[model samples]
Target: MFWALFLLPAWAVAGSACLRLCLAAVRAAATAPEAAGDDRALTLYEAAFLSGGPRRVADLTLVSMARQRRLLLAHTGWATVVDPRGRDEMERSVIGAIGPGGQSRIAPVRAAAAGTEAVRGLADRLVGAGLAVQDGAGSIAAGVRRVRLAALAVCALAALALALPVPSDLPDRLVALWFALPLALTLGSLLIARMEVHPYSRWASPAGQRLLTALTRRPGAPADDPAQLTAVALLGVHAVGEPDLRAAFAHRERYLEEPAAPGH
Candidate 1:
């Protein structure tokens, strides 16, 4: 039937996306490194990097600055540098992003912070130390997105099939049932992926997440140290006890909604 022509491409694309995502998830899980022993404890910055990738590292840096009274984040999303001198490269990069005027938007500051050599240094260390996966966290996240897109494609295909006129010999109900097959496949793949990937869904690898879990389980861990607290903030802003600091990093939705700043 002529409808077959339209349905074929949709089926192919949805099927392929589903298959690729499923395989990638399985391969990642099967090949992931086992957790390291507690002796190989992660540094605060390293924990930030592992738990939330470069942006989290940038967030940790920003929180650290605020805690040190070197920077201020306003509720309206402006960042002000109270002190210009940066004790380290990461701080320096944030200061540079604030420009010479000692003022800039928080979004731009985050962008610059993530691109700094300091962030890259942390990433290199994590990868080299084998706490982070070699393929990178982005790849895993991308796979999840691909599966989601495939599910949408399947839904579109089902709608199309329902809208098109079918042959007199073919039952309309049968066409709906037929299209449901690929729809089910795509949805099922997505469900499986979410379940399998959720455990290590953040920036951390299986090993890194395991270490993070253990680290958090300790009594008063990361509580006495500012740097350690910043790392915990990276995991989630809610973990930061300070109300202002928590609000400062609560821009996660903003960061996700907006495109990355240019040249970042």
Candidate 2:
């Protein structure tokens, strides 16, 4: 009982510190300009080539026309059955722009009953890219934790050694090994995690490389891009009562340029 009481405050303090660290990391990541840059690059890439800018408008018009003709049916009221022929036309256009890689070559467009997969795929790519800086920040937090854990382990071993009247050679060796091995691994992991790979980093044309990455990650419809795009669209539609695609695209660009709030 006495030992449990003595340990309670330590546990509380550690937990509090962990919470504080997590919150601080997220806040720092969210406000960072680099994180926002990822979003801008993705939006521009998609607008120029993939699903959003002109093609989506054209497709929507086609879909609307089809719906009016009753040649199409609504799956649930939220979606209408899109013509496979229209999909083929779009695929040809995409192939002309990017090349013959099927859905694998297209960065955002994915197969779905209605084009929901394609839209969602575009959104996911944007969100994932935006998260690069955040991931880096979290990695930094993790590195710090690793260091702290190593320190704590060392301290604990020392305390254990001291508490034992018969200080065996085995205990000292075990403590040394624990400190040495984990310290090396932690440093390596931290270095790799901290490597700065900007989310905004794009190709010369920007579309091809991004698409390739998307394809490599997902070989199926409903790729990450659409998911991300949907999120942004939903936010715009719900929060501001306007599906301001241009504004949504610009939001990321402006955020990226907004000088990372002094220190972070």
Q: What is the lDDT of residue 153 in candidate 1?
A: 77
Q: List model 1 lDDT by residue over 1-264, tens digit each.
A: 555665686678778887666655664555435433335766677777777777776777777788788888765466788999998887898898889978766776887888888888877766655566555534465566776787687668767766866663567677667667777877787677667776644456566677777777756656436455743544645576678776665653475333333221
TM-score per model over all chains: 0.77, 0.24
Q: Which residue runs does candidate 1 get wrong by more than 4 Å?
A: 26-39, 133-138, 166-169, 200-202, 227-232, 246-264
Taking the tens digit of each residue's C-alpha lDDT, what string does model 2 give over 48-136?
Answer: 22323334422333233333342221221111223233433433333233223221111122222124444344445544454322232
Q: Give the per-residue Cα lDDT of candidate 2 at 6.
A: 23
Poorest 10 consecutive residues of model 2 by lDDT?
Answer: 102-111
Question: Which RMSD does model 1 reach against the true structure?
Answer: 5.2
The Cα local distance difference test for each model comes to: 0.68, 0.35
Question: Where does model 2 exceed 4 Å of error?
Answer: 2-80, 85-264
Model 1, position 46, has a per-residue lDDT of: 78
